[model samples]
Target: IFTSTDQVVQVNGSAATGDMDVLANHTPSIEHIRPGVVEVILEYKSSLALGSGGCTNAHPVSNQHINIVEAAPPESFSPKAVSAKLHGALKVATGNGSEEEKIGSRKV
Candidate 1:
């Protein structure tokens, strides 16, 4: 979703492993990204919401690149809808549900 030649101060992104903050001269590596905001830090910070599929390639010689499979604006989501889903998930998580259901609810 983003391509830049400007100098970056830092970048914050989430992966299946966990969240990570990348800085200039970060070690080269590849990380499988999860669905979350990828914040690019520069003179002014900017962010993009990414879908579940993507990978980050961090190289010392070149800048970090995030390959996004899907993207959507934050405004596209309805807070009320999200809240309702969360409520149901919490109920399943706390109530007498199957083990799989409880674990899945907690993940939600």
Candidate 2:
């Protein structure tokens, strides 16, 4: 069984116990499944191997595709400049008032 939510794809079930091969497409099932127009692909393969004790073992292998988008760069900032601006604003807003007065004035 396969379940899809947003950009995430999940497969639940035991492939080792099945004989069928499964392949998934990269279109509506995976494309644009989330916030962004990302695409994903999933493939599963299973094989049975013979053991020395006359027993058979099943093995499963899976392949996945993940596409990630690059984020934009952030604007540059100067800590000293920001601090100076904040200090000037606080001084203008508070004047000679006490800390409690300033807090009370800003309360909603």
Candidate 3:
């Protein structure tokens, strides 16, 4: 989706191998990204989250193209709140909670 030269600091995405971040001057390579958050870190410390989508990085150094199957406007979240939810979900999923509770925990 990068049409112009917008100094990108880093790009984080979920690849087939694993979740990784590509920094400036990163080695040229291709990756099959899975459906997950793609965070683009800009030069001025600003960032943008491209909601869950799949992509392929043909040539990371030069022409970086992103073909998102689905997208949505980014949203902000609190780390503490997210952590709490995760902890609660884990507790329910691992503990002696009901099946319904464990199933619910699987959601965001």
- Provide TM-scores for the models: 0.63, 0.22, 0.55
Error of 3 at 103 (Å): 20
TM-score-better candidate, 1 vs 2 = 1
Please give, for residues 4-71, the per-residue lDDT of candidate 1 as tens digits.
77677777888878998888778998999888777777767666564656998888795778787887
* Alpha carbon deviation, residue 80, candidate 3 (Å): 18
Give lDDT for model 3.
Answer: 0.70
lDDT per residue for candidate 2 within 3-100, as digits (tens), equals: 33323233222232333222432222222112211122233432222211111122232333322233111223467896897786677586755777
User: What is candidate 3's lDDT per residue for 32-67, written digit by digit as tens?
Assistant: 788767877777765556555676564654556666
Candidate 1: residue 98 lDDT (0-100): 79
Per-prediction count of colliding residue pairs? 0, 1, 0
In model 3, which runs have C-alpha deviations exceeding 4 angstroms? Answer: 1-3, 58-61, 76-108
Q: Mind sharing the TM-score for model 1?
A: 0.63
Better of 1 and 3 by TM-score: 1
Candidate 1 least-lDDT 10 residues: 43-52
The order by descending TM-score is 1, 3, 2
All candidates: CA RMSD (Å): 4.8, 20.0, 5.0
